[model samples]
Target: MENYMMSGEGEKNSSDVVYLCDEVFDFSTVSSAFFILIFILSVTGNVLLLFVLAIYEDLKNITNLFILNLACSDLVFTVTLPFWAAYYLHHWIFGDFTCKFMTAAYFVGLYSSVILLTAMTVDRFITVVLHNWWSSPVRRRRYAMAACAAAWVISIAASVSDAIKVEVETSWNNLSTCEAPSDGPDIKLGYYLQVSLLFFLPFVIIVFCYSAILKTVLQATNRKRYRTVVVVLCIVAAFFICWGPYNVLLFVMSMYDPRGCNEIERLYIAHSICRILAFFHCCMNPVLYLLSQKLRTHLLQLLHCKCVRIKCKERGTATTVIQNVAFIAQNSAVTLDPHSK
Candidate 1:
């Protein structure tokens, strides 16, 4: 809040120096384009996945509950991307109120995703590693739903806490920017908290879960279940790969303050890129990618069946017409006879 200045940076006293405005702002267009594309793909992909999950009766299992919630989280995140693209293209026009709301929702999406993924991992751990003893305590779907509900609640709380720190600068080139508060300590603390809970902790837990699962698989030489195990493990690994760089960069920024204008600019560019990469993760979940394959197969089968049905209907109609015409002709010939034959 204290950092933004358009024409009066030089007038400020030396102790209050903060925030460097971009001289060119040239990256905004490119960033906007990339973000728009991400938004489109995320929305399109997640919506179809959600539809498939909703319709497919057999997929309504505990594991799929988490996957469904993940898709929901992605949709929520995708909704915010367009706003952000608009913000980058033209400064925040929606005012501070919408800014706070958008920022909160944006973080809610992210935090919920991480929380859900962790929940999924822990559920898998229990199912695979401790299946006989662990799951007896609770019903799987009910428990998974409860966990997802708790995640949503926790995510809302976290987002609101972070949203309080958002501030609006109104006159940045006659536009407003809703950004994190410019308090150094607060920014550092936010970064630390985010990196720890959202990335590091989740990453560690997933790794631990998978390690145990892998050990379990190694001991029992059932090659039949190995493929499913491997696929789930790869999904978890991809989650980390997608989000790791962004969190690492965020940590680095928290630890190292940008000193000079050039350093600041470079860091700014890097941060922008990392933010895009991080946001793009909402669209690239492992579960969704796996589900996409199944969905594609199902859709193709449905289309093929539909085509067959259409052909069958066409043939049936033609046969019915021919039969009716033959009956009419026979009746006409019968009627044309002077005497009954």
Candidate 2:
């Protein structure tokens, strides 16, 4: 969950005074509980979204494919939440290998999700801005597949820098924490990389795409197109709003030299809360699906079908029980009146 070194130890000032603020705003248990909640919601929501897309929506559509990948990226990110929850409550007991893997996988999920969102924006821009640009459906599908693959590759590569340097270290409190080494130049590299790739680049691309999309939609009288654009804009807006503060704080922390205990403690609290907010973004996408008429319809139809199937199953069970009871009654009657027959 944390790609940078945490202030888990004391720091010395000019007068030989050591400042340790580990006891300040102690909310480890609460944070862990919230993480568990996020895990459950994110898993349930993304899984349901994927199911609906697979059953009720066409994968051949590039937008749906991007959506499917985005959900998968969210799942990949969310699966790490339980481990993070445990780490928050206690320490890293999973060992070095898992620490590396989970950290890498987490970043991979984060990076790919951002990239996929950017790609989705571009796809929308193309569809709306360049409507007349035609190509074979097969070629377009291939291009979409390539974009998905590239996003994963780039994410994995970016994650390696953080994962390889990660190790389990015993902090000043005698608790083992998983974190990147603070000794090397790589200490600051992760923060800068994240700020650029995860936030800055994606923000620029999304802003440009949506601006073009809005201009085109406004000039035309197409309500459907305008509505779809608005929904996507909302999604993009939510993503940035949740992650923007976290990235900004991270960048500041990378360059920050805390002058006192209060400063350090305040930054720690802010960072932890911002991270939780950032993680919550994974769950937001599925909720945002409610804004999309197509996805909403798919979800409703899926629920309706499940309800209908359950009712049919119950009715069939009741009818079989009734038939069995009637057959037994007739047999009893025949046995009791054998001579009458």
Candidate 3:
């Protein structure tokens, strides 16, 4: 049986196992709108975060570096959202090159974000749990830089591996689509790899690191234990909630054989919903820092500086206008007093 690929929430055609589903709902328009909204939010939030970090935070700090890289990763995913939105609204209008490139870029962003998040968790684990394992700031800085570079490289490699399988071709619906080949094995393999690396692996690592950190905090009699635990739980829960369903649904759908129209349609609907939820994750990181005192302080300082500059410019303009008016009045008086002269 032919098997299709699902990338960026768009489906490819699989002819041999075709099942005509009853039109319970038309999700294309809604999906397109959601994608557009997500794109806007992700871009705005991530860009603002990046700007704040660049201007007010030290890049040498591992945490700040990870935050910067994560924002970039979100941006990379977001920049491709419009294209996918267009694909949902219409057929795949763009040709082969964009098809491959966008797919790869999207995957790169996804994988990079997961990697960076995991890296950040590990860094925190080292700082708290290990407590003195790596005492040198310079060494930590070098390692952090290397980690970021390696994350990008690995993400790119994974993305390219699957991206090479994508192509622009006619779907079973007779519309052009960007999709993987009609090979069941390839589709299954890709889904398995994605579920393993993207979801399961990172999720496990993050949980383990956070659990250790929480234990450390508990034993230390720290006053901030409750707050730390809550924050840790929220971080882990948010990641799982956003992406867990999407990956699970994808894995199930890859292995499932829908026997009826209703079953097929239900899967499609669920997949669409879960995929949108996953897309919402691009903006979630910014929310985690919404209550950060340092970030708020930096943002306020930046705004104050901007306001001060504007006021100075206005004062300078007012002074110049006043001087010009005085000069004009004096010149007019001199001209009018010609008889006296």
Top-lDDT structure, candidate number: 2
Ten residues in sequence with the least summed lDDT for candidate 3: 1-10
lDDT of each: 0.72, 0.83, 0.78
Off by over 4 Å in 2: 3-18, 171-174, 183-186, 310-341
Q: How do the residues 1-341 of candidate 1 rate in per-residue lDDT, one tens digit apiece? A: 11222221212112446654445235567778988999888887777667666766255577667777888988877788788788877877888788888888888888898888888888888877987855554477778889999999999998897678777777636867788754467666666776787889989899899899888878887766555566566656766777787778766755565554656666666767766777777777634455445656654554477798999999999999999999999999999999976
Cα distance off (Å), candidate 1, residue 184: 3.7
lDDT computed for candidate 3: 0.78
Candidate 1 Cα misplacement greater than 4 A, ranges: 1-25, 135-138, 226-228, 259-261, 286-288, 291-293, 301-309, 315-341
- Backbone clash pairs for candidate 2 read none
- lDDT for each residue of candidate 2 in 1-341, tens digit (9 for 90 to 100): 56444444434232355576655666577778888999999999999999999998899988789889989999999989999889978899999999999999899988998898898888778878987664777876888889999999999998897798788888677888898755446666756766786779889999999999888988897567467677778888988888888888888876766778777667777888888898899999999978888888888887799798999999999999999999999999988995966
Sort order, lDDT high to low: 2, 3, 1
The TM-scores of all predictions, comma-separated, are 0.81, 0.85, 0.82
Better of 2 and 3 by TM-score: 2
Clashes of 1: 0
